[model samples]
Target: MKESVNSYVFHHCVTIPTIRKGGPRNNTKTYSTVDDAENHLSPQHFCLPHTLFNRSFLVAVILLELGFGSIPMATSLDTSSTYSGILSSSSPCFVRPSGSGTVYYYQAIQVTVFAWGMHTFSSSSLMDTFSCLYNETFFPDRSSQNLIESDDDSNGAHQFRIRLNLQPGRAYILVVTTFSEIVTGSFQITATGPMQPVLSSAQPITTTASYVLSSSSPEFARPYAYDYNNVPYQAILVTVSMTGMYTFKSSSSIDTSGYLYNEPFNSSDSYRNLIISDDDSGGNLQFQINASLQSSHSYVLVVTPYRKAVTGRFLIEAAGPERLELTTYRHSAGPYSCGNKLTCKAGGLLKIIKSMVISVGCVGLLIGVFCCRPCTNKRKRTLRQQLSLLRQNPISQANSIPLRNVSINTGRTNEIDRPYTISISTVAATYAEQPPPTYEAAVLSSQR
Candidate 1:
């Protein structure tokens, strides 16, 4: 009987049974233990012993499988680390840096674990063999705690959740290990919040002008103008005031020979040339005159020891309005005399009158040249020829005339016999002249 029990345990413990056909039976029966069949198999052999032994073997195998094949239970514990893990053993774990800053705050932390084990007894008996353990450690304090609990319930698994109220700018560590069997697991934790930064202030400087000139020896000192406040200044509103001496000369030919000498001057040569420099501060901004000038002969010397800003367009309000007005200044040199110095005063007067007539005739000629209509084919042909000549030699024929003052004959006829002295003065004139009212006005006036 002992041999039979040992045989049954060994066969069922390692291998499952395979069905086979029965062939022979023993007529004689023997009893070795009390747990054997009651009949002792005296009359015939009984199969009850084989059936009872198989049933007991199956129950033991089932119990052993249940205990060994199941996973262990686990629980979470609180810690300062941003992350956590669970396993069969406990050891120090490191948390990665969360943000870029001197200080860091922890919002919350979490952990999880999984465990497994095995047994050699019945299901209920195997439950008593397995267990769960949770270990936690706090930083700075170094204080630690452990919890042990049975994990023998259904499926053999357990889970625990931990919440952490951690201090900022600190670190902590955690370790976990198993007690009875080879069960294992891991845990995780997280942290979150905001960070701060540093900054600095702005500085200021004075503005000055930078100049560029078209000519190598520019006549005037380039003026520097600017506004301070740092706010943008409007280029159009700003104006520059300049003061300097200007010299003018008229065309000698017109003074000595034109018929319109006494007539009111209507030509561009009547005015003085005023050139203004256009240079702003270092920003290189340029100012340009929006209007054109017609006068060139007359000159003015303005001395603006004082200046003022005015609101009107093109009108500069002077600090001393009266002093701002220009006065005539005479040069040491006398009126220019060209060609023969006549001995007869009558001849001088006649020459003056002839110059006046010639001036008028020139003006009339210009009007006729521009206004005459081509009434006939011959006139048109003549006009075309004149236009061609004018185009071919415009500067030589017209633009070369210089500016000069008109001279009136004031001496007596016999006075020309002696040395005649004439004085000349420079005067200021309008910067521009308006054109004749119409082409007809310009042409008809020529008849006189």
Candidate 2:
């Protein structure tokens, strides 16, 4: 009996017919097109677009079969795999040999394997010289810790190969670049391991969804680095179906910042549950957070502003293994408001009632005391008219006879200072020896 071996070939060959020119001192010959490069270096089978499209179409079909909304692990593995890609001027580049050095163009491909073991990566390029780096990060020159292993075609064979121990489900970056600066061309990578690897471009499939922050949204004391006090923001519950590195970015006119909190986000203690946060890293005063998230766990995405009380519409793009499950997250505890049932404690309620009573009582007393001048003046006018009528009666005024008492002063400061209740006869007798008292003088004497 013969054993059947699984083989999968993934290609990323895009042919740009634009002719490239090399520097004056450069000895490397430049190819005008992808076909010319393939004809010169690689086998005919390696550059076939039909095979590449067919594999992509197969993956798409598999995705649709699984609802096309989730990220699924590769079902099949190959003992050997082949991948092809091109490096143009538009490809991502970094300065070789660190600061103030020559710039080189490179392409980074993420390779993931289901079965862990030793994997070998070898590359063939149409250009005469190229190098490879098995790195943890994209720009290996930036940090030595990121560069796991590196190799160049020291044999002058126009090829490079590297061998490294890989863990299952961990994504390793295979960086391919030229030995010289500013060199661009097409290349192919063939990987062999315990299982056929899933070769995906370093870029993930990102899905952008629109959300909003407005007056009605819940608020929180954003992390101190962002703002001091509470700010209007929207919280999204992020749940991933697969575990992988994910990036969350915010785009809006409101200089936005983002905070990612682990399960059970406690707004009261934001820093404790916080997994990561960012501000203006996405450019244009937006936030970008890249984190490794676990499956079936809860994560809270907080969209706030760089300053307090900022509210507007914003778009959130989540890029990872799969489209994340995002929904508006209103904390089970809700917001802190005196009106909320959970937030209104007994002491708070008492304080609220006390405040209301004090405010209402003071306002009512002020209105009653200072707002009735016209009514008081009308009463005084009636009293004056009564006095004038008494003065008009000559016989009654001359007799100085006792009559019903007349109240004068209306204040209640003291018993004697209150409205006077003296008889008209007494008033006439008291003022008889002096000039007839004016009404104003009589009223002033009553007040005294």
Please give the CA lDDT of all the candidate structures: 0.26, 0.66
Each candidate's TM vs. the true structure?
A: 0.13, 0.38
**Total residue pair clashes for candidate 1:** 39
| Model 1 lowest lDDT segment of ten | 253-262
Candidate 1 at 314: error in angstroms?
Answer: 82
lDDT for 147 in candidate 1 is 30
Show model 2 residue runs off by greater than 4 Å: 1-202, 333-448
Candidate 1, residues 319-434, lDDT tens digits: the string is: 11012222222222332211223323455698899999999999999988766544444554565575456547857556632223323333446523221223343322422456
Q: How close is candidate 1 to the true structure, as a TM-score?
A: 0.13
Candidate 1 local lDDT, residue 148: 22
